[model samples]
Target: MDLDKVSFNGQIVDMTEDEDTMAVEAHVRALVLLEDALKKKEWLLLDREIEYEKSQELDPNCPFLHQQLVLNLFHKLQEVQLLKNGDSAGKTYVYPNPDSVNIFLGQSFWESKEYLEQWSRPGTLILAASQILGYRNVAGTLTASDIYAAFETWMNHNGIYKNGIYTCCGEALRDSVCKESSMSHSLLPYMNEFDETDLKKATLDILWDCQKKCLLVEHIEKPQALLAIPEFPIITTSLVQELIEKLKQVKFKCDTRADKIAYTDPRTRNIIYVGNHFWKQKDYLSCGSRLGTIILYVAQLLEHPHLFDGATKDITSETTVEHQGSNSPRSFQEPLNESIHNHDRDPPLPLKNSTPSNIGDALFNKSKSETYGKCKHTADTICAAFEKWMSHKGSYENESYTCCMETARHSVCNKSVMRSCLSELESRLKDFV
Candidate 1:
């Protein structure tokens, strides 16, 4: 039986006598070695390049002195997930390390800079990269704690911490080398405590400086409160402004010779613009383009949910033309009962339990005096027409609701005469409906 194998590797060899006892004894020895390694902070026990030779003479009892024993427990080391990768090998845990944080920030900024600058939005990428480095806020927005956490995790992952305690000056380092004592492995004690707001501000300042260096990072808030992530699918007041700026840049302009006033995108036909001179043409497009759509969604997500509501033509041009043709109905009027006599004969008695002038009759009387011709009327006129149509069936009999058929101002009625008068009325009614 190889006692060396059982003792060093902490594995019990199958034996005829006292097998359980042997296993217990081996396990106890393995615990002692692990505790010793823990005290020295040599947690990278599974690293292939462990310094066995240097520690063998210096510390005869060091667990690493027996390389075979460490290798034998490779399965156990893997089970614990402490097997160090190339970059993490020989690293130490040092939370809140500034230099490590700076390195990560530098790398992330350069990687995401192009995409951010192309869309001119910066907040999102910075926030996502920070999260990847272990600084995360639950609300999907950047916060101070997230920044600090990211830095700390990056420093630890990169093995930037010292292994022993040190004074404010050089004395502690000298003692660590001479005595071979454990070092201060944590930077949390030395780190200056900062509130969430201050930490957030510091993070912003760092990003702001990156922006000034012509890096694509940007903060949209006026005072630079947060980084601008332009690709994020959310709506904000600032995002709306960015979209408007892009639209304005592509706004169509014509020379003096052009007679028809129209707005169109000169570069691309993706957007649709419609409106008159009194109203600025509202730009319309599917919110699918990465650069444009995200900003629109952002505007809706933020404070301007109504930003895209009125930008497009609700009714098609075909419908507008159909309503304006010669075949179009002259005016909207409620059907009168054929049984009721015309003005040439006396009227019949009111229906059972019905008044001489019911609500329907009163409403019809109000609508009879109004006209909806080629000219557009206010909402009030449309409302009056609807109220009468909704009420009295017989009230429009005597009232002439005819519109001007000629395409010019009527000589006697003094109303604009146009074949499109019926279409205008329909359009106004549809709008109200």
Candidate 2:
């Protein structure tokens, strides 16, 4: 009935009558106003819109607008999940707009990311102030110690982000953010969520620069070629190194450490790569040769159906269906190119049919010579022992069959000492045969 309710769900109301139609126009107007306020980071106005919309939302449209509103309120946390729509690929689509990737953060942080190329940014500085000092409101009054304490609380609240930075910049920005944290002295108890937004924002600032400017247009495709994303993980060394010099233009570090965010890094143990599988550790966690496998899969999807099961395999085979694009195993419609084994081969000639001089006799004779102890006899001494060993199995025995075992020496005897043991029984058997 009002401007707010209509914006969230004016479409759902039947506007057949004149009064309802007037309400619909106001609803549309309200949504446009809401969208503009969100862009301005105007939370008060945005909150008002949400309150008005939520009071009467009995349908899906209201929830849709509400979700967008909530995300706008927390957009700083969102720079990490690129291309999240149902295949439109969002802003991270690498092929056509490969140069268009953007990390959503403020300009100061963006400038800081650009500045880090030449030097390290004070992570501890932010940790102390934005997160640690807990004194952004009383900014000038907080002592350095209090700030450090607050930063630790912040870091504790977040995951292990001693240096929560990995922008599009090509270099590493880690110069040690602090001399130390309160974790050492206990001035402030650690908070687990102190890493609210600055580090991620700072990292994005660097990322936007590297993605658009630092990484040369030519080199960009190669790194983006790694298609598999294991756990919304961080950037790669190749990405870091290639753009580091360009990032120098922005002052960002290339491979500076950050928590795996998706999981704890075993190397850093900040829960980097935590729930992620071990198979993709090299490909996704860092840039490596295996990432080519991802592109190969895409090729499989488009070019070579025979190369993939299509139904069973993932965009990346090890990437579970739940994790990647797949929802479930597809019904295998057709056999993937008939199996080479299906036609079968000469049935391996049954072990029972194997000659006494070959695998069967070899296994039999070898066992007998060892069990019966040493016997410095002729080739038949070994042969007879092998035949005796095989005699238990009707399949292994035959009138023409011979024994298999032999001591280490060329002699077929079982008692041959280690010193006399010269070569493998099969090799030694050739001379006797």
Instruction: Judge candidate 2 against the unseen true structure and give its global Cα lDDT, from 0 to 1.
Output: 0.22
Candidate 1 local lDDT, 330-390, one digit each (tens) = 1111111110111121111111211122222221212222211111222121122211111
Each candidate's TM vs. the true structure?
0.14, 0.14
lDDT of 2 by residue, 281-365 (tens): 3322111112222222222222112111212212333232211101122122111112111221111111111112222222122
Please identify model 2 stretches exceeding 4 Å from their true place: 1-148, 151-153, 156-433
Lowest-lDDT window of 10 residues in candidate 2? 263-272
lDDT (Cα atoms) of all candidates against the true structure: 0.23, 0.22
Displacement of residue 385 (Cα, Å) in model 2 is: 64
lDDT of 1: 0.23
